[model samples]
Target chain A: MSFNPFYILPELILTAGGILVLLAGLSTRKWEAPGKIKPYSPEALALLTLTGALASSLALLWRPEVVKGVSQFGDMIAVDPMAVFFKIVVLACSIFVVFLAADYFQGIRVHRGEFYALLIFATLAASFLSAATDLIMIYLSLEFLSITSYVLVGWLKQDPRSNEASVKYFLYGAVAAAVMVYGMSIFYGLAATTDIAAIHSKLVSYPPDGSPTHIIFLGLLMMMVGFGFKISMAPFHQWAPDTYEGAPTPVTAFLSVASKAAGFAVVLRVLVSVFTPGVVDWTPMIVALSGLTMTVGNLTALPQCNIKRMLAYSSIAQAGYLLLGVAALRLSPLALPAVMLYLFIYLFMNMGAFAVVTMVSARLNSDDIREYSGLAKRSPASAVAMAIFMLSLAGIPPAAGFVGKFYLFAAALQSGDKTLLYLAILAIANTVISVYYYMNVVRYMYFAKPKSDTPLKPSFAMNMVVGFAAAATIIMLISPEPFIQMAKHSAALLTGTP
Target chain B: MIPLEWYLGLSAALFCIGIFAVLSRRNAIGILMGIELMLNAANINLVALARYMHPHILTGQVFAIFIMTVAAAEAAVGLAIVISVYRNAEHINIDKITTMKW
Candidate 1:
């Protein structure tokens, strides 16, 4: 249980940054006038903090000793390439969200400091979630993330919709978390240890007949209910569309990408580490989940008129595709890398789409699809970027999403398992169904007549974020070699291979 | 001393009751109460398992303590959100807070 202070520099930076931002905000509250202090002042501080955290995380990538898998502080937090990869993703997503949020929150009249502080805290929790190896660490980090997110969803305190969204999210999140803890308790009872690897070793040492297989199965199932809720998988996905639509758009974007990434991280860690092959056959269950998730998500998205709700379903569908990798984990070597690569690509394209929606909604004050009519004529650059994002999300050629989907399908097919192959085909069909709705957004932007001919102008900061995302998606599509290599390296820690 | 199975059974029953309450209750605070019950069920399991199964190591007891702390934090946030909802909608029933439909 050797503690290394330097090992968790990024988390330290975020915690300190959050406290400082809180104090800064409270001190500023004494001013009499609302517009006396510009909102950008706090936003710049947030951006600075996020930039520092990202830099620290990136610095960790270059440290060879840290890159080699080692559990920090007595196996509670694992400092490995896999954790580093997800932390980088979380930090980068927060940075991008801050940029987009700086522009979004400029119009809102809330206490800006708390919002940024909570966002940073959520990021810290997410990083902890990806790295957590002990059950206590996992539960604490998850609750930390959830608590911050609940407040962020209702940050627009005056908006009734925000209030509704937060209440629903709080209720669902609390129940799911409680269910997950119950499962953890069962795990502890079975193994008499809270360390995940220790539990796995105990399970392995005790023969299947000797151990309580039924209780283990029940616990794992209950835990999946919580993870599934976080990732917005079907049957646990009822809260997503409403939450996405009602919460602030930047929060929606954060939830869609960073939060989902953390969910997948925890799921992968637990399933691969604790529930290894030959111990329990959970693949069939994952296969069923994948099939239902993609189909339900794609089909439900078809009738949605709100852009946020449609994207919410699209993200759920994306989660199904990611789960295909998890399902094929035992059969294919490419499974972990495929999931990792997809999340990286998902960060850019999905965030790009939501940022465009934010821009449009800001201009028209509507999230309705009809308001996007002739968006090309109104904002050509944004419309073009939106189309590219739509194409990428639909898994069309020459988009990064196509490459991500390609690897997942290839991984599933290469496994040569009958069920996995069938899942791959089902995913392909879902991809086609998804295109209709994604392209519908594009159609409204390109083909539909405008209700008003007023030209929309996005802020300079927004254009930069959108442009960067679109370009990254295209670049990754064109040359996925670097990202593929990185993904493979990051995933090697989990797969236990070079 | 009583067998561990009895304690486990009692906690399991409590957890089920909590789940039932969470699903059946229309009031927001009632659902929160259900969540607390479920959490306490886990806590009981943790402490009883530690006492019966692994007397030397207090990991389960420690876990129970952490769970209690976390449950307190969760209840605080849950109640705060409920109050905000009440202020906005003039009621805490889950049914009345449906501003955003699925």
Candidate 2:
């Protein structure tokens, strides 16, 4: 099997860039100027690397072979339109995070280069995860992502909360990865192959009456534990709130949006490719999980005073809504596209919310909701942007999230499955339950009295990220046709069972 | 010759013991050990299944090797984190590390 170098250009770029950033961190010279708003070398290099990778990913989207789906690396990974789209999303997320971190670590005396390098590596892992077509590739890339995240979460070694957060994340992540690998071992035993396509073919070759249905179900359930932990699904979400609250806010944003997207990408790929409808009817299981996940996330989010913790729960609920798209995959043609669209929109809104949180927390050194009182007076631009993000997250009309949710729920309804229909209704109730907490931040920003009248001036980099995210969010709602078409175009995953 | 069922049973028991230790142990290092036990159980399963079921291919054996490598790396990182946590909290007790509510 000859390895094709052209197919993995983005990964190569990220690898080179991560190494370069890590090496750059060893320089002793000061790069920051006293008065000018210039980015240091690590930030500049990371941005350049991400931009290059993003361009390559976008180029892959237009390749005729890639659009049709091309298996690379001896069928360990697939460079399909879906993979390219997710690669783009993940790269864009890293780019925005670099900007967020620039202003975030401005005053802190820490190793900025290592942080950027790890972020790049995490992005690399996420990109690999989204495209992995073999069980080994899946396990390797998922663990790669988790280990990098553990380090990033615990980056502030001196802070006890950061240390605690990293420990919790590592403990949960290691156990989950082990369990997932065990499940993959079972699949290997059953199929005698690691390639997803071969596994699917082997599973389908079993005689129906003598099929090892119970064992297959056990493997599937075990694998979901790892995937569920990544996406913060119910019963596996205990680590999220503490981790989000304790970690630096920029890392929190990256984990919520980028990591969760990668998790969903792999989940959808595995379910659609390896466990096709003829092999295993997983729709019922997905429906139950989707309903339970949203309810748990929304109910837990109600009493959170900490802003980051609240967003953490809200992101979990968002994961549940995303799962609706997966549940409807076999029944509705719109399901995959709906998931793509929601994740794309979520990238903007969630990051925008966190960017604001990062800025506010940097100034006040507080993530408590009460600290946001009269934010409209202190920083009208940020307050308004926060309001836009909050409204969008709550799925209000005229915001991008409403359109995204509309497509997801519409996909579920279009499935014509009764259980999915009930799940969709339950999701709607979860949405209603979620609006109160999301708006609680807004009410404080607009109506509550200010603790201090001093204006909170956001730095230029943060301003750019927040402004770009806000504009993208509103514009996506206004002209959602192109985005929808992009999502539809990118939904052509390579299924093996067909 | 030992049957495949015997190997499968042994691996399952090991995995269950790992889970029990992970849930019951309060020491962070003990939990880490449990995780290692679970990983090794899977390793045993993979290698045994590969030998008995698919002797013609090295897929399961190769996967087991990769799992072992990754497991080692995981342990190193996990121990580093445990050390850092201990430095801050002055103890490695999982129950007492609850600055944030579980």
Candidate 3:
């Protein structure tokens, strides 16, 4: 028997991380030993475990490029450039989130080990969701992610807000997901296949536009609705700001960046693999949904005062922008790269924003915008980091966010969808509106007066992590060739075009 | 024996009911239950359609099985969250638990 072990690197790293946390919970002896079952000082122990996991994920950077369409487990996984690229992104994101989580758990009553374990497990599931080529695999993987996240969201069980955030999240998430499954069943009924590729092949010539199209259209719409709820797109995005605010900051960061990206990952897969050459008649509906989502998310965000809530609404709006890329799947020269590129830039811009939120909140014990008044006077490096993230998010010049939006709008334009292109331009206008709220923080940080004896110290860890994110944003803006090329290559796997 | 349209109609009705509950339910657990019913409806549709449309194919059955597994996992996490809510607020009614209600 031959051993085929090449495609398991990312999974192995994640599994090892999860097991390490579990073992740490089991093996550690304690000075006071709070409880025999509940590990003592689990925070420090969990932090170390997260560090180890982060290191393992970084280890993937050394592996050779994985081409697309390298299937495993009866065509369960498609280990192409797209999958490999996203796996790395998810992996790297988990590592950063773990760094942010340890502090957030300081006073929380949960076992830190379990939190880290759940984090690893969720990331692993997300990776699976991203790489899954079969419907069964996608559903299974998404379950793994959802369950872990449900627990993580409510990790601070003592806090009513935390519990409420989680409950609302679960209920809404469940409904959308069930709807998605129902839609999938419709596809299964029509195509008689659970493999995405098989279903796509079956769909290709089944009378391009007819009653079948209507039925398939309904199914696809239901499916995207479910995915939309997951990513917290507007109309379906009611749960995000609450959940992001109620969850611990680290968990919020992970949920916003990695989890949303993971969901988008599958959205790409569904569009590219199962509805290749585009779900023609379905495009108009998506464009309209995308337009409404972007417009509503940004417009609502204008009145938010809570920092976390602002970011939450902003994230929803960002998902709308990402949706524009998805809507262009059939319209452009290959929209997959556009999607990948946006996600890549999103990891930096969004995470940097969350990192600033986490760090500032950790020190100030608040998530209110007013609390961030005079951050620049208090902490220069952190202040500057916040500035760059704001600029990037607003899609200002010399930010990766600008380049990403440009590419996506360009794709829509090339797809010859004048309406979508106009919506994309209006999306840019929303970006301008977003700039105001984002800059409000910058203004308070630089202009307002500090109000506390709170020591404003930027440590090596904060500098290293935030600066790394900031530096990445800068590099992607100045010279995004390598990364865009990587995204383009990943795009090829889905579009079947080089 | 029930006709295949009966099963499809029944499944569609169940799904519609699920959607209605999700839209109207105030309690978080109640909403989750609605979602569960909807998923079960999907499973029924998949099995019925598989048996009728492609009598020889097992794909729909397999898909239905996956849906069930996912639903089970979802319930586990969801119930745990309900317990978490009760612990925090001393209330099981999601309507009263507005502290974190978004």
Best model number under lDDT: 2
**TM-scores vs. true structure, each candidate:** 0.97, 0.98, 0.93
Q: What does the lDDT read for residue A339 in candidate 2?
A: 94
The DockQ-based CAPRI class assigned to model 1 is high
Using DockQ as the measure, the top candidate is: 1
Regions of candidate 1 where Cα sits further than 4 Å from its true position: A27-40
Q: Give one digit per residue, the lDDT tens place, for model 2 in A1-498.
A: 567778899999999999998887676234442222345478888899999999999988777878888888899998998889889889999988887887777666678788999999999999999999999999999999999999999999989999989999999998888899889999999999999889999998999888898899999999999999999988888899999989988999999999999999999899988888668889999998998888989999999999999999999899999998989999998999999999999999999999999999989998999999999999999999999999999999868999999999999999899999999999999999999999999999999999899999998778888999999999999999999999988885543227
- Evaluate all candidate structures by whole-model CA lDDT and list the values in order: 0.89, 0.91, 0.78
Against the true structure, whose TM-score is highest?
A: 2
Ranked candidates (TM-score, high to low)? 2, 1, 3
Kindly give the stretch of ten consecutive residues in candidate 3 chain A with the minimal lDDT sum.
Answer: A30-39
Candidate 2's TM-score reads: 0.98
What is the alpha-carbon interface RMSD for each candidate?
0.9, 1.1, 1.8
TM-score of 3: 0.93
Model 2: residue A200 alpha-carbon error in angstroms? 0.3
> Model 1 over residues A1-498: C-alpha lDDT tens digits?
577777788899999988888877775552323332254466667777888888887888888887677778789999888898899899889988887776676556778778888999999999999999999999999999999999999888778998888988888999999999999999998899999999988887877578777788899998998888888888898888888998999999999999999999999999998888746779999999999999999999999999999999999999999999999988898999999999999999999999999988877889999899999999999999999999999999978999999999999999999999899999999999999999999999999999988899888888999999999999999999999999998887787831
TM-score for chain B in model 2: 0.97
Model 3 root-mean-square deviation: 3.4
Candidates 1 and 3 compared: the better one by TM-score is 1
